[model samples]
Target: MSTLSHDERASLADALSRVLARQYGFASGRRQNLAIAPEQLPPIWSTLSELGLHAVMVSPDFGGFGGGADEIQLVQRQFGRSLLVAPWFQVAICAHAVARAGSPTQQGALLPPLSDGRAVMVLADRDAVELDAEPKVTQAHDTARGWRLEGRKTAVLHAGLATHYLVPAVTPNGGTGLFVVDSSAVGIGCHLSRLVDGSWSGDLRFESVDAQPLEGLSLQHHGEVYRSTEALAIAGVTADALGACEAALEMTVQHLRTRKQFGQSLGDYQALRHRVAEMYIELEQVKSACDLAAEAVEGVDSVQPTRGTAQALLVMSQSATWILQQAIQLHGGMGMTDEVAVGHCYRRMLVLNARWGDTREALARLRGDGMTKEMPGVAGS
Candidate 1:
């Protein structure tokens, strides 16, 4: 979408589809919780890196595929298709931050290893919700050895698995600065926890953490990075929601065809059919909005991103909730159990809605950006 030529889009989609088909099956197994000791992640990480997942997100200057928001959305949709469990989302997003802010020397040192999956990364921000909020916890100070970072960030995705973290902190001069810190640093501590979708995140505390600042980093680019990253995130999750909704719809359709009640199949009932049709209509609407949002975020240099991503999240989250709810209701009791597909889809929807902001928070953001509505809900990472 946006400035991407039709050929670029088609080639990218075709490549991703072919490479992910096998990994997609593995992801499905993980989502279903069918495998014992399913935590083996090195192979999964190696596969994604080898397939050029990280390369696709990186800039061409850094030996990357030079992709942007469109690529982020398409690949994320595939991840959503299988609920793929990997640290790739964090790695690509953090690497993007480095490419945008790091000096040439830093970029050359960092980007290649990440491209080949030899390193893992994640991003940590203090105020992930409000664009206007200043960092209260993490701050940096001048030190003879370099810069010393001190603060805490909770709910960091892939905190334990990452080899390094891209942390945004408030400088003593009242400006936000981005820095890279080794995960093995002495003063850094991490408290692990599980998310609703069965993924891991951590609460990190930094005490006198020595870090490498991105040379030539500017204040304007700091905000831009956050906005850009959030846009990419929304795009990725939108694709994921599309995949989950599609899968759930398929499951519901299959059930309707086979399950009989009142001596007739559910497909033979008019009311259920109407509900299914309504679900399909909403899914189509969300699918369209997500595509436009990805396009807008891709051209974020010119497009107003807050409005587009907020609008997309609002539409997708609403439709996802309703669609998954209908899928569960139609499937009856078994839909509530982990033995079925729709149940996992429901969990994923819950996690996605909770990410950043849900439907209500999205509407509030849209309103704050000059759209009309009453305000409500809080923001989080």
Candidate 2:
């Protein structure tokens, strides 16, 4: 259940919508600037901080709202509609992990800066961490001085903008351990690249890099932490993709109503109307799946969160692809151009689908988990 009342949720969503409308529209070069040089977006980030969005998921002990998955869904939905590129994965995943499991010292040092937008911390692991995949390159060694991390993490989300990295490594004991590495540390190397949706990612290399563990967590418990954190991350992006799907459907519908062929608007065509109806059905399913996943993340009372989240992503990946493909097909040749909003929406959805675990892998992960009859969003449920 949501901590905020219905009115408050509406008010928050309206505020976010107004701000993005005023300052963050995808008008030609502005979209290009936001995608290519997000570092130049300090003003927008500052505005979001002042609105207390960064503090939404942070713990109240560190002067935050201590909100749950509902708040994350609300904020991310607005950003997704506008296709705003920010380091939100950092807040949604890394900071949540620290707040949920960090020692008092770690929380005190990290959460305040994060709440005020002074710092951004990203998760550095393999592309498939949602499946509990072991790190292929990074390893951690313990010494009297502390933990030292070696090896590299590739395709790190928002890595170029991060102040720190929450990295998972294979420890000498063969258990997975989480560590915090300062991006400016001496042994670190970062190479940035532009993704298909015009967002930035980094290939990060660490050579004998100094690091700090989230205190009080033994290696035995890190696996649980990793799974929950990654699950929440999936829920976050699913909400974002839901918003994009909504906008894409709306845009395509509008195009169909207006664009005429053979002296008749495209909407007059029976076959095209049928396609729109199918897209709407797919969208409703996506909405259901996304909501179920968010609720699962909030409760986290059982392994349901993991199974439910993977199931939700799979539903979203399949449904959203159909919605966007139909949106593009209905838009005809115009949809293929970057100027069309649906084209951008398609690219963003593609990235979100593949970012964690894609449909095939998520289905495999769900194959053996007994379905919870109570949560219909999960596979086989």
The TM-scores, one per candidate, come to 0.86, 0.90
3-110 per-residue lDDT for model 1 (tens digits): 346697787677766666665564455653334222335446666766677787777777787667777777777777666667787787777778877889999989
lDDT, candidate 2, 1-381, per-residue tens: 235677887898999999988887777424555545634434578889888888888877887777777788888888888888888656667878897668888999999998888999888876222245443447789988789988877778788788889987777776667788898998998888778777877888888999988885776566567666777777777788888889999998899899999999999999999999999999898888778788768655467777788788789888988888888998988898977888888989878765665677567668843222111112211
Scored by Cα lDDT, where does model 1 land? 0.74
List the candidate 1 regions with Cα displacement exceeding 4 Å: 1-28, 31-42, 126-136, 299-303, 369-381
> What is candidate 2's local distance difference test score?
0.77
**What is the total number of backbone clashes in candidate 1?**
0
Which 10-residue window in model 2 sums to the lowest lDDT?
Answer: 372-381
Model 2, residue 117: displacement in angstroms? 0.6
Off-target runs (Cα >4 Å) in candidate 2 are 1-3, 28-42, 127-137, 299-301, 368-381
